[model samples]
Target chain A: MARVRERAKMRSTVRAGSGAAARGPRTLYDKIWDAHVVRDYDDGSSLIFVDRHLVHEVSSAQAFEGLRRAGRTVRRPDLTLAMPDHNLPTTARTGADGRRLPVADPQSAAQLDALARNVAATAIPYFDATAPEQGIVHVVGPEQGFTLPGSVLACGDSHTAAHGALGALGIGIGTSEVEHVLATQTLRLNRSRAMAVRVDGTPGFGVAPKDVILAIIARIGASGGIGHVIEYRGSTFDAMSVEGRLTVANMSIEAGARAGLFAPDERVFAYLKGRPMAPSGAEWDAALAQWRTLRSDPGARFDKSVAIDATAIAPSVTWGTSPQHVVPITGRVPSPDSFADPVQREAAARSLEYMALLPGQRMEDVAIENIFIGSCTNSRIEDLRAAAAVVRGRRVAAGVRQALVVPGSGLVRRQGEAEGLDRIFREAGFEWREPGCSACLGMNPDTVPAGERCASTANRNFMGRQGPGARTHLLSPAMAAAAAIRGRLTDVRTLMAEAGMGETQMGEAQMGETGA
Target chain B: MTLIRVEGRAYPLGRANVDTDMIIASEWLKTISREGLGKGAFAALRHDPANVFDDPAFAGAAILIAGENFGCGSSREHAAWAMADMGVRVVIAVSLSDIFASNAFKNGVLAVCLPADAVAHLLDAVRGGAGIAVDLEAQAVRCGGRTFAFAIDAFRRRCLMEGLDEIALTLADAEGIAAHEGRVAVDAPWLAMAGRRA
Candidate 1:
């Protein structure tokens, strides 16, 4: 505690001496990025310091081996945190007897074992499979408060943008860059152009952060954000909770953006107030004061700007392999002939064939075999509660082959169980599994069968991302629950109406349809 | 990185939005080794026996012409590794994802950006069995005597030409980094001890 207080005090003092007030108008990314530049190169590249580094099992093994081969140690092992999530089985083997199951896949077991050995040898902080904090690296970073406001965080995984919800500059790096950071604690990168995506008004009923992000991706195609960092602004983001903001930022990469962030606010401060790694007492106040200055100044210039009306966004689902190939849940599948771009038209034809959908078929009519309601994108307690509310007294539809709900982390699992959310899921015929990245990338035992269609709450919808030859439609937790209940891609609003859960109970705004 | 000008038959795999996941599926990422990835390159498309990578016409091609936003998904360096493994030295597209371009450069592969029209012309030439040549020194690509210029960062071009990796670049300024660290140790002792044991 003394050390923590001293570090906080030192940070506070440093901020006092720096020219914080006299700086010109700057975007949130600009502010955090400028603070972390250790050296700037003449060729528009800089060796920027990374405050925190998150690592996972699948991508870090080679990086650690590279470090070993070079006869060098981690430059800052204390700042690095490791965990195994991608290759773990979500199902329990003891059948309620609580006997832990050994990992059955030899390859997965070997990956985890290598990670364990690497962490132990380097003395880096790690959360093992049995550790309470074990979870996806993106989820664990924010929950542990290692992703503090105004810090720069990097990870080998692409969803590291999820950390940007706390007003930090979070970036995804490749294995080679991971090794670079491990040896030098800095990344040499060329600065990216700045973009502002301003969303206003309230979202409609059944519309979620997932819908808003998907709608954004639909409006601006996958390549719209190339070579840029996006800042999500305006009233809708202001009204959203930190969890919702995280979901939106998590998929920024899907639109080809380097990173996405929301400015810190009172809600952000409240969320981090007592997190395990958050500062305490005077240190908290000092950090809050610093965070308050992290927002964008009025009239800050952005290279590109886009405006979105949140009321126009509906419950969305992807019809094609790319996240940009999404349509409103109530809409019909688009004909490839409708696309003006030749490339998009060809891609659409391929996607339609792979998805086995007709051009004029209603999205709600598309049958689904599996429903996955967990991932780093939407596996928090709030996500679970939203899903539980939809499945409280319901049963899975007859044709729905499987319904699985895996929490984001053990802590999230315990919280949901305390609230009886797990019971609600199980009673509704949904399998309540332990926390890990289950079926998100299908790197483990939990996989969507080949040639089957699944409604998933994960971020990406690329071809075979969930499993070999598996078709995935990305949606929200509530929408996944509705699909499980209807055995098709049904809108949550219609299900809520059937359940007599009025719009007020849904706690989401309602608006008329605005055509895509 | 050896600065050998690429001159060979080019494969026209001009599909847009070809993400890294399509290049190499996540299922193939369990192995720590970067070997044998060439077999998995374009695995999804390879399922079709007539895919360009496997077509006898494009076999042993060192250049690939792809559509816009090539390699857009995931931060997997395996995408670049797979291309390198398959003996692809250059990829010409309308644009490349930032991470993918960086990975390609690090793995000794060249990612060249051209206008959609230029890419289309190249695709036509490749379909006609004409050879493609990329001249880094001239920053131009030639196809059947038609020259097209492409822009590249001078520093990156120099690194590619000189076979310099990031480690070598950083080591070039090792003395400067040490001096900066020494200054930071005094100015912010807390940050200096961030990675040090108490």
Candidate 2:
């Protein structure tokens, strides 16, 4: 450890040389980076220690293969959690007799079997396909409380930023970096700039947290937050539930941010209390004491800042291939001529052709053939409750082809069943299926058909994301449910009014109103 | 994975906001191996017979000029693997996604960010059948009697120049990693879990 001692000495010397300048206010990203740096090189690069690693099937198989080829063992198996979700089917994994079913796709089966073998060889903790805790890596990390505040987490998937909601720094790495972290629990990287995006004021009726994020992305355009880590602030985020914060943070990558963070507070601690992975009793108090100091210092300078008014946003959905192609539900489809940039105008025109829509068509009038209410983005217990509030006493429209409600995890499914949400969904003609990444991506058996339009709660609306030639419109869980009920894009606020339940009550976390 | 200068014919496919899914679709990602991804590079655009990737004129182009946000979605390194396997050594875009840029750097591929005007001019020059040259040591792109200077991280440039192995370099400092672990044990007691957290 002579090198470590020398580095420590060098660091202290630099700190003493800087004096009061080094004691100035620091942002949350700065504090976390400082705490995790193993060594700093003079060439603007640092060796960062990673605390947690979340592994999944699609992006991790090659990483495991790389480790095997290099004759290396996982450095810290205790800090890694592997789950098979991306390629696993959301169809019935268990029968009434509790016997497990075989995976129909040979490719998915082999990938999952390889994952089990790899996790076993590394002795890393794994939630296998049939495990009740097995779910999307992003969802399982937060719900299990394994993604603690003030920590660094890395995953092979881009949406790992979801853990940023809990005040952890979640980075989406590639397979090579995954193998790097496995061999050595450190990464050679450069620090990203810190940006503050504050949305103040209260949102209007039926504007869920999903809507807020969508509006933000639409305003910022694609690639707006590149090369920066965004810190979400202001009253709108402060008033949102932990689940809501998770939803918002999950889509930060869509806006081109490295990761999105919300400083930890009482809501975060309350959500983690008694969680399966959370420390309890005296340990809980100790953890809380440290986490309380995770906020950004007042007067800390940010490289960039954006201020948004929450009241100006409304329930929104994407109409084109990119998340930035969004508009309020009351708005009509935009014409290519409306775009000042020729490239964006061409992209808009091509998107309209692919989606088979005219420029003047209203959003609410666009017909949909399918509705998907699951993904790492909006498949939590809170998201399910929100959709159930809209689907409680309504039947799926006859014109709509299929409607599915896949929970994030087995625990979420069990909880939804306990709340009679399963019956509500089943009675309303929507299939209540098991959990996996499902139709959010086309990796599994559940895929949208070609030339079909679907209202999806997934994060991406990219071309051929669901399937070859599949069309996806991004929206909130409640909005997707409303679309399933009407066979078109109907505002959830309108349905809430028809049922005499105010939109404010539907926004509540407790899901109290089960309209019979 | 080292480079000093690359001079070759460049492909001019300036589509903006080209996401990773377009580079390599999810169907191609199921493979456990990283080899032969060249066939699937530009999977979506290749569906068209007139797409630049399949066009005979740019069949083996070593450089690709693209619009802003060239690689914007997914953290899949396969996007880099696909492009590298397709014989692309240099990618010049107005801007690139952070993840894609890092992945490209790791794969020995150079991601150059130039002003929009420079990129637009390069697109026209390359389409006019002029070759492009990138000099990393000089930090400049030369083509059509014009030079466009750029900046890159010094450490990254050195790594690319030396072809250093990142994982091996990190493992050389195992003592430092162990020291960090010792600190984490006391600071983050909740991190210990043998199996499932329960």
Candidate 3:
């Protein structure tokens, strides 16, 4: 009894340690980080206590298989959740691969089979591809309220930062880490130094959350934010809605941060209020009362700080192989020497070689063979509407091989179709497919033909990611749509003007479309 | 579960940016079993037929000498499972993409991280039959009789060297948990009963 009480006392006291009670106070990251610090090592790594672990078909399979091989069961299966999206085809099919073909592809079938076997073998609660609730693992976790504020969430997906919108410090894990978490519920990780990326001022019209994040990634090269957890702050972040915040956090990994987070605010509470996994009634009210206090305190310290002006950010596009290879749509390809470092300049030169473009060329003039405006990164309803607004009256360029729109979730798909977003996409010659990670990783049937260039809304443009020898340029949904119509990298701002359809402010217009 | 140091053979991939799709291609998704995954380990490599795995260059190697960002995509445990199945005991890379390294460790594959220069040296040593003995207990690698240190998160090393999965760790505390539950059941029978009702 004394031992338990002593441990409890240590837990409570530690919560107030590390400047949490100092005059300068603690950042939200610090508070959450402290709360989850199960054990601290001399070398500065932490045995982080994970509150929630989200898994998916591809990554969870082997961890469960590992458990079975060891004659063990899932230790805290109740705290674990699973969903399969990566290899699940968008269209429903007769065979098990979930493809719409007369015959199911054996490889895709095997993925589903292994997922089912693992779930059944370990009794892990799963949302299979055939389940109505199944969607991208990142989207499902937050929507189901499985992600809560002040908790440490880990997933095998890099975009696990999508859950960081709840104010949790989420981390992406590898298969062994997944296995580690399954066995120990603790990950041996080196804690990252915190960096506050403060985006001040209001965004201009026609600029969306994707633009804001793309702008941030452009400022911080693809690896600039490496080895840090970025805590996003300031008026621009305050102005974004829950979904908008998720959009920002989702791309944090693309910028090379372990995770990205926004301090919980009224918008977060409003979104979580009646969610299935959220607290209820009196519990909800109490949770809200506590959540209201979960922000970085005044004068909190950050290891590094960067201030970006929201007004300075514009709709952006990538001209090379990485998310860092970006410039404002109005800007031209940069001179390699302008990179300021020979290494980066050399990397830029190599990227240019693969892209088959010369430095100093206008970005807008680069012709594209395909335009894909979907992926977990930018496939929510607002993303769809943004693309729809651009393609409502425009037809895709004739030579474009594939112009596709894939919603992130079934809920998003239903909502988009209800609002006629699908009609606008189809009218503009875009393939409106069912919800799944299509063309996101080229696991499913949707792939860019070899050696072609595609303007995509998906994150990551590493070599051969979209398809074998296929080149990708990551952009926002609207920009992708604009490129689809013009057969080149056309700025959405130019298309919005040409179409005479005004753009919506980031959160003000979209948060109004919430399910509640 | 014993910390037995084994000087496993090493294979050199010498490739950079190996994506998950290449580790275990999308076509092998049909079976629920991981039994034969290693046979198809480098399916994408076999797609070309003349790739390194089949070439005479690094025959009988048990280690994989790879480039940076060795596993850089979706967190597919199959990739790690495939590598383990293919008799790859150690994967030495200058740097590993975070997710891939973690996955590799959990599946009983050693993902060793060395500086770029150190990795190049290790690669040259392995090719020359200077067997690298991976000591999980010491968290060090002995190549050509020279002990060079590599870092592993101590907790992960404990789990891997013991071959303990997550459940085993949790179950290790099962007695403490049951005692706590017993106390909770006595103090808050309603809560205990509530669990049963659910």
Highest DockQ, which number?
Answer: 2
TM-score of chain A of each: 0.93, 0.95, 0.92
Residue A338 of model 1 has an lDDT of 100
The count of backbone overlaps in candidate 2 is 0
Task: Give per-residue CA lDDT, model 3, range A385-424, as digits (tens).
Answer: 7778778877999989888888887777788889998888
**Candidate topping TM-score:** 2
Go through the candidates in order and give each one's C-alpha lDDT.
Answer: 0.84, 0.87, 0.72
lDDT string, candidate 2, A1-516, tens digits: 775566566555533442324758988888788878887778878888898999998888898998888888899988899998888888888889999898887877888888889999898999988888888888889888888888899998899989999999999999889999999988888889998999888787778889989988998878888999999998888888889999999999999999999999899999998888787878789889989999999999889899898889888999999989999998899998999998899899988988888998999999999999999999999899899999999999998888989899888899999999999999999999888899988888888999999999999999989988899999999999999999999988999889887756587662112221
Q: Supply every candidate's count of residue pairs whose N, Cα or C atoms clash at under 3 angstroms.
A: 1, 0, 18
Over all chains combined, what TM-score does candidate 3 have? 0.82
Superposed Cα deviation of residue A76, candidate 3 (Å): 4.4
lDDT of 3: 0.72
Please, what are the lDDT tens digits per residue for candidate 1 over residues A286-355? 6787789998889788999999999889999999999999999999999999999898999999999988
**Candidate 3 at A453: error in angstroms?**
2.4
Superposed model 1: Cα runs more than 4 Å off: A1-24, A93-100, A503-505, A508-516, B171-198
The docking category that best describes candidate 1 is: acceptable
Worst 10 residues of 3 chain B by lDDT: B189-198
Against the true structure, what is each candidate's TM-score?
0.93, 0.96, 0.82
RMSD of 2: 3.3
On TM-score, the stronger of 2 and 3 is 2
- Residue A214 of model 2 has an lDDT of 93
Top of the candidates by lDDT: 2
